[model samples]
Target chain A: MNYNLPVLLIAIPILFSFLSLILGSFNKILSKIILISVIIFNIISGICIYNSVLKNGNILTVIGNYLPPFGINLISTYTSISFLILLYIVFLVASLIFVSKNDDRADKISSVLLLYLASSTGILLTGDIFNLFVFIEIFSISNIILISIKDKKLSIKGSLKYLIITSIGASLYLFGIGFLYGILGTLNLSEISLNFDNISYFSKVFIFLFFLGSIMAELEVFPFNFWISDSYAGSKNYVNILLSGLSSIVALYIFIRLFLTVFGYPTFISFSYSLPFNVKTLFLTIFGLSVIVNELAALSSKNVKRILGFSSASSLSLILLSLSTGLKNGVMAAMLIAISVIISKPLLFLSSHQIMKGKGEKNLNSFIDGFRRNPLFSILFIIGVFTLVGFPLTPSFWGKFLLFISATEKISYTTLILVIVVFSITIELFYYFRLMHKLFIKDENIKVEKTKNNFVYIFSGILLASIIIFFSVKPYFTQNIVEKTTEDIFDKSGYIKSCLKSGEIDDR
Target chain B: MMIDNRTLYIYSFIIFLIGIYGAITNRNLIKILVSLSIIETALNIFLVSTGYINGSNPPILHSGMKLISPNSINISDPLPHALVLTAIVIGVGTTAIGIGLTIKLYNHYKTLNVNRMGDKDEL
Candidate 1:
């Protein structure tokens, strides 16, 4: 069987992660070198793979010499490849953040970071339902370990919470897969959808619960959102950056795949045609309320991490709102918002952490006196806040603009209502700006205390913020490619042709 | 005789709910970990049992049993078995790591419970 570019893209990371384990991924320099080399190699490979996919339309790669739905196929439609490429950037930036002049654990943490990238990238590209489960488990395992590398108490507590809580969520997904498999007799999502015109009510129930549970954990929504706040509040700032920014985006990507490709549940993906009052209205109502409440939570938060946590929730709501659109515009908007959050959140995390001492908890007030003395930091923080708040000219502003406009075209009243409810939460900005006002007002009084002026830390934060802005203007920088990736979402024949063909697959 | 598939599913759901309750309410980290294991077990059982038919043998083929036709053995589905084995490995890894962390946490915090570990600001 020929290798599918997308499957290979997914395989490259997992393959390296496994090898790193054999060669000691977490404790040595040799392993760290291997790990980084492998990721860089894959990133290069992903670039080429993405190019080929764009030119050829789509490609499929089957594992174990078997055919589709049986052999565990990996389909590289545009979206997964786009995410794979985006993930490489996120992980690369994160690596720069972790490496430092005085970082003793740099070797070990970089190794784990590579594994995180592999698992997350795998999540984006895998087509088999069971394979997706394996990727999710890998992601949870690697990330829990990564969080533990922070502070002793923080690591232990956060890791345990992450491990146990996410394992429960993963179990739900496994149960759902079992239910789906028993009835449909297949583990491939594409095949399952093709085989059954409509699933039984029982299967529907399983699908709804399983997908919701898993995505809920990753997205940090209402039910499972409990774990992430403590994590963000407790873990080192850099770790929180990885969790809030990159991890959640990958999870959202997986959610979109499941929502649109597998379940095809119109409840989430918005359609252009008139949806029935109860059908469309109910879902939007709940999603809209989530956006409002999450914004309010972000506003009310006292701790910096908790504030970012709530901000992430708001971003999650926006992406969910975009996905609920179900139209072409919705898919594009989802990717844009996801890219925005993942890129900007890291900038905020690393910058805040660099400013504050490695304290157990991070509060907005923690950085008081910074605005007046450190205009550099002040500018970065303001830019970070601006991006988070979706101020004009930021990545999120454009991202949310696309989503709001797409949403309004179909359901103007719904969009207006959500926008108003969300705007009301700007009072929360008082909490953040108050910190800024304090820093600026007290600028000269406080001294820059004992701190590590590491080049990597400062450089990483600046680099992260710069990338955020760069993408904002020329979002077409990656947007051109990512949006191109979304176009292949409905191209099922491209998957089937490559899967069924031996050498000359019709990659139309 | 018809098997009660519906009853099997109800039983599975009940087990899952109990596991969730135990996980949420339990105080000890090990006990919470055990509850998580229960949840994993319940999910695995649901997956494996879903692969079962009224009358079927394990999917493995004995050397002497290849005499006649391919379809007549009433072979249980092998896919869930493969999937479950992976799940089991994953579950063991998570539990092992959790227990190790709990032990470390106990040594550090002087308590196996979450409440005492907090406010230490030790991280």
Candidate 2:
């Protein structure tokens, strides 16, 4: 039998999410087993899809026998496959942590986790615009449930805010889709891209704004990110991992895909026939402002989780800054920064669960005597901090180095943006160092609790840190992968041609 | 104004703005949810309106329909109808989740006013 990797990648998890729920009522352990096996199967299939794409170009799997432009299809490229693999790895590590802990709500959490994975994977693989919206809704709903798993007042409020704001954003996006379908009469992404040039300038700008405004909430940008700090602080560590690792990456991917491919650079339109505003410049300005705002928020926040949330938001804004450049080098730099952030942020979040063992408070004071309790975790936390701050010998350092180099190569208004970027980094370093100093300070009044070092925390933290180290030591390997993914992202004509071809084999 | 395509769009836009106004200005949680539903319904109407033609028939080919020449008959676009169905379903799910959370919040805070639900100081 022919194996269809893309369909199986999505279908397996969705199938198991329900199965796990049913099995959970009977036996929770059996549900956990089912969840793990499905994840492992997804990982293996993701690798197979990646290898196949590398060997035989892009793979397109139509849902039914209908041809492209008529049937919904799943297209897997190098960049998407890389994201898929990263998502699987992160989910696997997180699941291990979940299993090692004993909670009364384990069965419910496991099922929601599976659905989250499935929806995110669907977002990554779908080739139609409407399908993307559907998956995004599923992703948001599951995320709301995940955040409110504890049923605390704080979690409930956070989830409520998230639900209301995101629902509004999704409706705005659906409105934009209605406008697009009315004008182009097609929902397929490739078909839309093909006809995008024919749209009037006013309509183009309106559609772009609508889409940008909607996605900004998910990407955790300036205006729509008011609830981020609360959500991050209220949720559990594992849920934070899912938020920072999987959800953020998927949202960023969608942003990049929509901007870089669908309403792409206006090559066919004349340069002089500009819209009322320059979208590229507008994006850069927004991202630049977001970077400064996030850093300042992080500096003033007393809660550690809120600080981390702001830092993650700042990192996302910086990546968006690079992407706004609309050049190949800029795309590569964005990918590099994205990878480093994805790897290091989760490590910091996971290790914090161990580092802040007995601290009932999430403020900076909790870290006053942290080093005395867990020296190893403190060290790992410091390392993760250094990586985020772009110190030498870390993946973030190389990523930032390339970003600055690319920014300088442009030699335009980006110089001012670069200055803003550097100044924000300085602001970030100030609080990070303060936290570090707090960690190492010796205080006799502080009672150091002997926190048990669980295998799950140490294993996942060490695994992620080691991976970061491997990438830092071998920058060339990271560079090569980023370059290939960048190339794949920018090849719009190739994507359109490959997706629109008729009568392709099912590869099932 | 007579009811026309332009009129439908105008009315939907007005309703959408009203919803947004209510969502921003209202202090009650249930009112905000109702406003959100209003916005959703307005968008659904707008989407379905996009597929409507002045003189077109429903996009169904009956058994007695002949394979006429191209452009012989005007038929409304069915894609947006299908899309609106999906959007309505999603809207219902979102509303249910919103109401569920509102109930829980009311139970905890003893008030439906968003401003009365103070910031959570304790986790």
Candidate 3:
């Protein structure tokens, strides 16, 4: 059956996202049940679609018969499918966490929550830049709302701050697209990428800056994202899970689409040699620096979520660093890290929520007696922290190994990289062991009663631990999928031929 | 382009710069909002400018200029303008939400200055 799967996966969630909201308002139990069903269905269908695409090589679910370059299109290439599957998994966990007894806004906030998922998933699936903008707007607005779901005064303030900054960010993104369209006269990504070389050199430089202007806001790397702390700090844990997990993934997806596909290495700039490095080298250097800066801030952070936030951002910068290499290996490393963040971050988030009484109380000492209070969960949390820190045999260790090997192989400068990796790992290990030691040893040894672990929490415990260990051992489990995905992305002639010469435009 | 060529791009950028300046420097809640509006306006103008056609009318395609130079066939790109309109409505909607929040915040904290609005832990 010609299932038109791209739009189907996106549309189903989109519909349920709204349906879940309405359902939650009327019957909370039904809402939770339907929401879980919808997410599970999403996961199942994503796998089906992914398996189909894996066999077929590429699947384009063009919206309403729209063709490429001119008409809006949605292509379900391998990477996006992989991303969708990851997204659904995270969404499933998030759904569980949101519907669980603890979250304050789970019931009240269900309306827009599903919509946010649809928007983010839609952003990942769409083909045209303008449509991407639409989804970005939707995702950003929904994200801001989701962040503020707690309805506390501080939450509202933080949401507003996020809304203003990201709204401006989205507008700037649109405005930049405006110029790209002005010069190239098309919003279709592949066509503009082809035509990019023909544009003026001055415009090329401006366009590069335009990419920086738009993506930097989402990257939250430095000066552009000064609001990251204020925005991410006080948000509810589940929404922050979405923010750090799915939303960041969506943003990085857009960055990859823009940076790699449209303008990987523009030849028009005359002063290219002015910089001592190539594009990939630049990605390595800049992101390596962010590793230290973010780690330093993360170490000093008092709020546990903010520390996770910083660490997420820190790890995110490393992924970007890996991507800067512009090699298949680098992309492989990036995808591995992405999967790690998707799985492990949510586990940690749920664990953190379980461990804490309030937002700010999740200090190092809080987890001192965690083993006694909830031994299973506490052990799972340690595994999660170990995974994050890249302890040997964990999936992250392999991912980090790939990143290190890729960087060394690509750059091939033994002394320089030796210093960079050491410093970066040191910076990472410092905060990690600090938090680790705190978990293991503390002056205030308070006794705690054994609380009953939720079935869902136990479920998450089993799921994340296995997946962490699974991918760590067989890196090729995901590596094969990601490698195929990157191969598809780099297939330029295939895309152009597929778009322009696909016989009758299969506009399903 | 429908608009003067230089003004279409340059002015929007200038307005964007002004909005950024205001967002960074302004201490008043309302003023920052006004600046956000400025930024949105600039972006809207920029989005629409990409769709403009020189000496062309809106993309009604009414057979009004069939005999005109088809090579110079000018129809203001309706797609970009439509996207811009959607963005403007969204801008208005988010702004309204922001205003609603600000009102709540002002009532609770009794201040319009964002700096003075919240406690250390909450903010």
Q: Model 2 chain B, poorest ten-residue lDDT window? A: B1-10
Quickly count the clashes in candidate 1: 6
Candidate 3's C-alpha runs over 4 A off are A102-108, A265-278, A357-360, A410-420, A442-445, A506-508, B1-3, B67-72, B121-123
Q: Model 2 chain A, poorest ten-residue lDDT window?
A: A266-275
lDDT of 1 by residue, B1-123 (tens): 755556667787888899899999989898999999888888877877887776677788788666476667777778778788898999999999899889988888888877666754432
Name the lDDT of candidate 3: 0.72
TM-score of each: 0.88, 0.96, 0.92
Write model 2 residue lDDT over A237-339, tens digit each, in one string.
Answer: 8888888888768987898778878877534211112346766678888888889899999999998888888888899898888777776666777787788
Considering lDDT, which of the candidate structures 2 and 3 is the better prediction for this target?
A: 2
Better of 2 and 3 by TM-score: 2
> Considering every candidate listed, which one attains the maximal lDDT?
2
DockQ of each: 0.65, 0.77, 0.60
Over the stretch A394-478, how does candidate 3's per-residue lDDT look in tens digits? 6567667776776566445334554655676677678666665655563354555665778877886678778878877876666
Question: Would you list the C-alpha lDDT of every candidate in the order shown?
Answer: 0.69, 0.83, 0.72
Interface RMSD of 2: 1.3
**Stretches > 4 Å off in candidate 2:** A1-3, A266-276, A502-508, B1-3
What docking tier does model 1 reach? medium
| Clash pairs, model 1 backbone | A268-A324, A269-A325, A269-A326, A270-A324, A270-A325, A270-A326
Error of 2 at A312 (Å): 0.7
